[model samples]
Target chain A: MKERKSEGNEVKVRWYGYIVLVIAILFFSGVFTAFEGPLKALDFTNLAGDFGKLGTLEEGAGSLASNFRGTGGAGAKDAWMFAMTLFPTVMFALGVVKVVEYLDGLKAAQKLLTPLLRPLMGLPGISGLTLIASLQSADAGASMLNTLAEEGEITEKEKNIFAAFQFSGGGTLTNYLSSCAALFAFMTVPILVPLAVVIAFKIVGANLMRIYLNKVCKQ
Target chain B: MDKKVTPKKTVVDAFVEGARNGFGISANSMAPNVMFAFVLIQILNLTGLSDILGVIFQPVMGIFGLPGVAATVLIASFLSMGGGVGVAASLYSSGLINGTHISIMIPAIMLMGALLQYMGRILGTANVDNKYYPQLFAICFINAILSMFVMRLIVSL
Candidate 1:
């Protein structure tokens, strides 16, 4: 984590990053899905568009196209076909996420998260900031842990406990928000409630790991 | 004061780089994992394991005021969070589960979601010991189950 300051390099969070982050959130939220107007373009489902619908000659009378999957399919063959279709969605999403990162959008998020996660993670010093980075990306968090371990700043048991915290809701912010789009509209509670619970449980899970390592594993 | 020297790459280049990474993950990780899930589900159907599972899980699901079929959502989440939510949405639309159930499930799903993949991504990347993997997974399960109970209580209130 200290690597950032070695050459006096602190991340610059441009104002545009916040705007990009908001747009990114809306793009995935599916709010524009029902809009028939220009705002429909704001939605990922609308932006990716749809596969060509078969005309009267093929399936006829139906404006809705089932796309390539088509009806009953079983076993590996069907699985392959469906996975093929998912490629665009996953690729497009990460692509947008990448743009967000390049534009410092993730840093914009990190600035907000650092204060919250710092107290929750309870690391003594600079490492607290690194822990917050883990909330957005699993790789980033794990790498921070790896560095901390290498530096001997964290004990093995603490490392294991931290692993449990991260493993439970890996990439909590990005994965939760992006993947929860489908369930978001249907949720009766406010959006932040579930996310807050997930964070709380991540810590709960870490303590569970701590107990197991201390009492059961004894490793 | 000289402005910070930003990299010459434009946003479009960043997007392409990001998209390439996405393609790689889809091809390597997601495609195979999804295929594995699909085949596993098919085998469960063939062996009548799904029905057996439903019967077994119903009572546990009942504690949350959900149907036995809701177990599929949790199971899917264990494999992948998105998949779990997909299963929940489909079930909800079909009227098998209600809005309250989905609300209660949100945290539970996020807590346990994508463990199979994250084991490699998070722990392996962190260089955490191999022996700790099972216990860590168990912790996730414990957390998920506990959260559902809490969420159910909250929603009721």
Candidate 2:
């Protein structure tokens, strides 16, 4: 009974520590944004010019009166171009994950991650794979958790932790590309800082819930 | 009456079956999610909520080594995944932020996902007991706040 109380206290201390850390970071982020104002404004004008060029290309295509024109218009073509450029990388990542799974490489991964996870996050070893899987695809990671639950590879408590991990980590290739591409174009400090803040909050938020749920909820 | 043989299920059938059994969550949820995303975007645009959120987060955003207006993009990211991307694209096209800012924001947005509401569906599908859901959510909220802080620290250093 005494040990349990100490454990509970430890969790509380950790939780508060995280909270304080987050607040401090936000305060600092605000200062950083203030410092970056002028450069960001300059970048904004450059971005407008770049977008104008893209618009001109679209207008040029619209002026063309060929039989095969509309379907192959600049906007449509650009979208396709973007897709083609990104798809190969996604496919390659997927293929690598698939091959690894087929060879039971995940089991080895799980074994390796177990020690670190328990101490750092209170997550079980097998959950390491689920966490990694989530980084690639939310649906795939969730499905993996479901499979593990069905197969009894992890307990219900562990599954909840995995769920929280997924909640925190699940973002696909497309998300990364678009967000990055947009921010890169502008060089605006204002636009970049908050995006970073919220994302960090979400990740930490999800993980903290995982830890909390593990402790308070019954298995 | 003579001998009969059973045909094997095709790959597609097997695949469908696997998805059905494995996911367990309703595919129909996508419709609501998409619809909500649209509604959220419209509201943000109509009310100029994006700008407000940006202003609100500005002070806190400084430590993270990002600009104040980034809050708008972050809010967009939260309302709809695609909307956030659209905001990013527009910002990029407008030349508001640089490659480094973009790099920093990208990971942050990816880390956040569609947090609050989406988490409900996720936890629901996971069949997490209702009693713990609220507490878990609280923790998630706190975690997100902390994640922002950590990202700021990393970028600043």
Candidate 3:
């Protein structure tokens, strides 16, 4: 009975410790307002004007194509413009992530994360590779799991636990870059509170999934 | 224990390697989705479809602790992970939302990755028999919603 009580206390302390650590990280990351003040004061009229000019050029091309071919080229033109603008950024981000990995950054990252993640997630040290890969590239993470399964690095049981943790915890960097702009648009007190709640929920949700898989699924 | 150890690469080498790996992954997976999203958003913008969608989603936006106008970013973020970023950039570039809005939205967006769903699909492919996909999705979706609510509450205070 004393041991059980002590164990309970330990769990409670650990849980609260996790919460405090997460909150501290978020507060310090400046991820909350990396570009708030300057972006808000920018002159939008000129930017809109630039977009208008691009639109006009697109329109001109569409009219020319329609006059010659009797089919409006607006859709094609819009698609092309959008592709031209967004593709490079995605490519650039992907490239950066890859280079990070090829240089053994992920291996180093795995070593650093292994100590904390293994105990916290109840996963093996090898699982760190999958988690780190997931952060940069979701597909890579999945592939890593598959490879591990093939190599028998982990049992079917371990695989399920790994899956639960990865599913809940993967894809941090990509998500951040993708949503940074949208978040900047509606920054307000009301918005901030919900955002913080979501952050907490994500952390707790992932941890809960880890615990459930470990304790309940006795593969 | 005496296996020969490889020396650590320099920072520049690491950066270059990371870039290369990133390029390969992007080309294979992320690029196609990004293209699809870009095309979709462009068509929406041109045909004013986004505005129409914005109007439709306004009420739902309130439930999520966002303004009616902010629905555009939320929906965009959902459709194309980067769509929200584009919307935010446009709004900020246009001087529509202030710094406070930017601050609030950044963390919310950062924490809003569809990792749960993404992981579920990957695990499904791996033939892992534990059917926790629904539970995982629910946890992530609920967490995201709850986080947003809590963030709003804290910032409001």
Please report the candidate that would top lDDT against the real structure.
Answer: 1
Q: lDDT of candidate 2 vs native?
A: 0.48
Ranking by TM-score: 1, 3, 2
Q: lDDT per residue, candidate 1, A94-181, as tens digits?
A: 6777788888787766655545543565433445545566777888988988888788877787788788889998888666545664
Compared with the true structure, all predictions reach lDDT values of 0.74, 0.48, 0.50
RMSD (Å) of each candidate, 1 decimal: 5.4, 14.3, 11.1
- Model 3: lDDT of residue B71: 58
Question: Candidate 3 on A1-219: residue-level lDDT in tens?
Answer: 123421111222322344433433343234444345654322221111211122224544543321121232233343234333433344444444444445444455455567765566556666666676666555677778877878887776667656654454345555443333124224454222433344345457657676676678647
DockQ-based CAPRI category assigned to the predicted complex of candidate 1: medium
Better of 1 and 3 by TM-score: 1
How much is the lDDT of residue B42 in candidate 2?
A: 43
DockQ of each: 0.53, 0.13, 0.25
lDDT of 3: 0.50
**By descending lDDT, how would the candidates be arranged?**
1, 3, 2
Model 3 — interface RMS deviation?
A: 7.0
- State how far residue A79 of model 1 sits from its true place (Å): 1.0
